[model samples]
Target: MSENTPLPIVEEDDWYRDHLATVDEHGKRVWIYPKKPKGKFTNYRTVVSVILLVILFGMPWIRVHGNPLFMFNILERKFILFGSYFPPQDFHLFVLAMIIMVIFIALFTVIYGRIFCGWICPQTIFMESVYRKIEYWIEGDSNAQRRLNNAPWTASKFIKKFSKQVIFFSIAVLVANTFLSYIIGTDQVLAIVKDPISKHTQGFLAMIAFSFAFYGVFAFLREQVCTTICPYGRLQGVLLDKNSVVITYDYLRGEPRGKIHKAVKGKEEEAAKMNALLGDCIDCKMCIQVCPTGIDIRNGTQLECVNCTACIDACDEVMTKVNRPTGLIRYDSEEGIRTGAKKIMTPRAIAYTSVLGVLVLLEIILFATRTQVEGLLLRTPGMLYQKTDDGYISNLYNYQFVNKTSDTLALEMELIGIDGRIKWVGHAPIAIPNDVTEGAVFVELPPSELQTGKNKITLRVRSGDRTVDQVKTSFLAP
Candidate 1:
């Protein structure tokens, strides 16, 4: 290249791609102190957070048919959904539900970006709305917080910090207890609190561990949970595309950035000429100042962004003050910014939605068609056919019954397909109540109905007059 040739232009802001906004170049965490956000969007998010928090803390206590509305007792292998009981036998339904959830999240992310993280995620809700709000109340806003941290260790600072820590830890404990209730039931949690510590030592310790974990996450980890720890944040690179609607800086309308300046006393023509070259943005960094994750929205979308809309509120305020039309930073897609069009139903999103719909429908059908009881019958181990005096071939079998309802089941078993008589080894019928029942029975079939080696047989289990379950097993013969 000759001296006359122009040098290629390079983007300085592209450096943001190499490192997280919440981390310094040394790989150490950079604490964020976002200015207290105030705008219509912030208010809307507060309402939503309040509603979600209420639902979360209250769900364990909400009962239907004498059981929690929703409970996932993984320890006992019991799950209750909307008063429906599911034992280990219904694990397939649980698996299908998880698959459906994954597909739904993919579909939602492809079209709407990480709105879930910003609006409904429990982490963001507690950090921004709960803990952070409390901090702001105790220590004042961002500038005040910075000053307090940077100041010498005085009694005032110690008192303020101590009070904040106490409140933060208290909230963490409450959060831990609330979540524990979801897993173990509110009654169990209350029992652990009311009972002797020696009797519930493990549960008490678990609650303490969870409390400290929550405290550390909200107090220290903060934005790192979204930027570095959460897999959903990392997934943005793969899930998001030009068509996805996300919290975006309208670089097309706000670029060629320059500060807004008043005209000089006499050089009005020059000032007007310079103003013509500038865009709506006045180069004020209010967006960056209000960002929770500490990224500049003007740098374009990055993984650390949680779509919290704080930047949108801040930018809109700045724009309004500058007499410029608002929405310099707003919810939009790259394609929409470039072409002035938005398309949500892309092929990828449509495909994901289709798959999600099918799975959800299948889940509903399976849940509706699920039996009240599930039974499993197997031939007794190391036992063979016994020839009876009545010229019948007998096989000893062990049966396990899972009751999936609140009511006790008086179940009677009958042979199907093969002409056989079921004789209970211990009891005549099985009584299952809210748990599993194990028993033994002898299935006797005439030699005419027996096969040479293995014969397929079905057992119909009935509760009163309704068929609750049907189990199939093989009968071994001579």
Candidate 2:
């Protein structure tokens, strides 16, 4: 074909585009039976999935500075990340961290498409590597699995189905326990497991509920979690652009597709001539068969595509067998495939990157400057100034101190500005517990040093010689 010559137009009915690949015209679910993928990329993904699984299941048991490495104990209104504890007072920091994570995900998605879903997502890792592999082992390949599902209730089919169910359920239970450990702590989880069901009824029920949810998702829901449920998959339309690198089919090199013909005795020259006019693609549908989400790469990028690179491996294998160059399906932007130009640093992607960097830096600064103790001082309600016997006006105030650190604090309140006295109702030096402490104190100021009406007074909370926290409250004065 000449450069000036137009490519052949392969027109087909657009009915397939009207609905999803995993659903029928009546909106019923269409079960996908994807052929097991095998290649260099698959092996690499297997290694990555194994590492991620180890981290996921082991993180709750791992401790840093006597605290779980990562935990979100929402019930107790406490959270810990990398050993740093975040109480309810520091909830804003958690919100900021979540926002930063969102920005990072957005930036990554704009540059790399949905590679995270395929490579690092927990659901994809467990489904494809663990559950799917087990299914293949017990029920054979895609064809065999389909046949077994469709066949009547036979002893062989029953055994395979029962075995797969048993394994999936057991794995789901383990997954649920690991998930709960991150929420309630591993020690509590172990205690619940060891204790009787009646002793920890709520925890037992929660574990059972989580186990069933996981089992249902991996066993029945499957790819619908990505295509229909997960918000990240839907966000691809907004986050991804033409410059984003994704698994794509090189239509420019593989189009005008034709089947390979065997060399015959009399038609050697004819077959060679025919092959010269055809593209590298042999019209093999191996790419479609290996797709987990059941979408054809040759049809262009679709929402159902997970960017798993399974199609790339499958297409490459077919190309090798046919003595053709590989990469009929590969990781390339749509712009690269269309204009033969690949650009990674688009303006939108750079803007997102810059915003994400700023957010991360701000979060780091916040964490660095955060105080270990929080103090609150407020004027007592419905109380006026009391004239003291020493010609001084005294204001009764309520104080609350929260200690975020693990150690207790010996706190003493001191007036910051003018010469004044802080007389605690109970004792001279107050001992603040690890969590929270509340008390009342009277701040007495002489009339010569005080202004009329309301006056601002600063109270400094000191532990030994170091001022740990400070607060300002309005004091009633005449």
Candidate 3:
């Protein structure tokens, strides 16, 4: 800011920029019009929306092994992810997964800034691209919505309002059902639908709860979901830097704006003021109207702005009409604008991206290395090895098996490392349940192989031709 530059009439206190930038003169949350976005970025957003829709709707239908590709049964403390089965014993893996996720989010925010808030976040996706677009279609654009809001009660108004509510709630319900599919699995969701109401009271209640929350949040809370609710939005200031790319006003190019008529049209001396001196902007306030968060980008970048680029489209439209070039407002940095420089890939960004890449690689490695089947063998406490009538030293042990695949497996245990032979006390081989762990079995070794005090042994469990699990335990010998 220069000494010649006039102070913002919107805020004129004896201080610097106000922290509460988005509040109106009355101190209420300023409602924004956000003139329908167009141009290159808007087109890019459409492609992303389609990809998200497909992934969200397709995940529950995907099956890996004999189980849903991903299912979180918190009630049972069981989870089947990818093709691997996990029980309570695998909780450490889950904790590690969550830690990785949090770190990834933080690192991403530190570099790319609010790209997640504007483009990738589910709340923004559903609100800006999906729900709001639907509303615009049904009720007409922003100005029409303003008129309808002010218009006295009428049949047309009633019809439009009723239709919007119905559609909003309907979509919310569908979203809830799709969300539930991830939790309980598509098969179970289908079962709940097919089963009698009496059989699924809890499921029905859960559906209701999800529907109400989704509907209320989208319909009523709306943009406040990002501003007031989202913890990430609150954290943007700390995560963001002046070098980060964000939707911003090129103050050097756009400042000293004046009315079109006052811009001096024909006279050579006056024409220079309109052409080169006066700047590209005409200060029509088109950008202000299109802001979702209702903060003027011209006031410098603020936390409230989600960087949706609605202002860019609106400003571009204004510039085209006024015979001036666009991008007075665009995805640029304050530093870039001040120095007349282009966006740069700074070292901070590179470092953050490198960290993200490493995290992703580690996640992939962990997933790949996860064992398909879980096996454990432990000697029964306070029990000594018994000599069987058949001249075998028998030791009671507990066996637990987790079948990672979709199909049931018939498995058998074998002994290795200083053992004569392995035999189950009862059943020779047992059927392992699919997507679950079943506990059973006892191991016996020939007396000829038994040591004095204790013998160390390795037990291998086999399914088909594959060695699914291996366990090491001490065999007690008296």
Among all candidates shown, the one with the greatest lDDT? 1
After TM-score superposition, the amount by which residue 209's alpha carbon in candidate 2 deviates from its true location, in angstroms, is 1.3
RMSD of candidates 1 onward, in order: 4.0, 5.6, 4.8
Which residue pairs in model 3 clash with each other? 65-406, 66-406
Candidate 2, superposed: residue stretches over 4 Å from native: 1-13, 427-434
Write the residue-wise lDDT of candidate 2 on 397-446 in tens digits. Answer: 88888876666678888888789988998974454433678889899999
> What TM-score does structure 3 among the candidates reach?
0.87
lDDT per residue for candidate 3 within 1-478, as digits (tens), equals 9979975774453222654544565668756556667767777887888798888888889876567888787876768777456776777778778877777776666555687877888888888888888889988888998899889999999999999999999999889988888888787788777899788899988988999999998888777777777888888878777777788898888877766644335576675545555667787887877677666788877777887877888888888888778888988777777887765567776776787678777777876776657777777777777887878787887766666566577787777666555656566545454445545466777767777888888877788798877888888877
Worst lDDT 10-window in candidate 2 = 7-16
lDDT of 1 by residue, 1-478 (tens): 9979975554766767666777776778788999999898999999999999999998899988788988888887778888778887889999999899888888889999989999999999999999999999999999999999999999999999999999999999999999899789999999888999999999999999999999999988899889889998889999998999999989989988999667999989889898889888888888998889999988888888998889989998988887889998999998998899978889998889888888999999998899888899999999989999998999999989988888877888998877888898877655555588888999999999877999999989998899999999999899
Winner by TM-score between candidate 2 and candidate 1: 1
What is residue 253's positional error in candidate 3, in angstroms?
1.7
For each candidate, give its TM-score against the true structure.
Answer: 0.95, 0.93, 0.87
- The prediction achieving the highest TM-score against the true structure is 1
* TM-score leaderboard ranking: 1, 2, 3
lDDT of 2 at 352: 86
Question: Candidates' lDDT values, in order?
Answer: 0.89, 0.88, 0.76
Q: For candidate 1, give the lDDT of residue 414.
A: 92
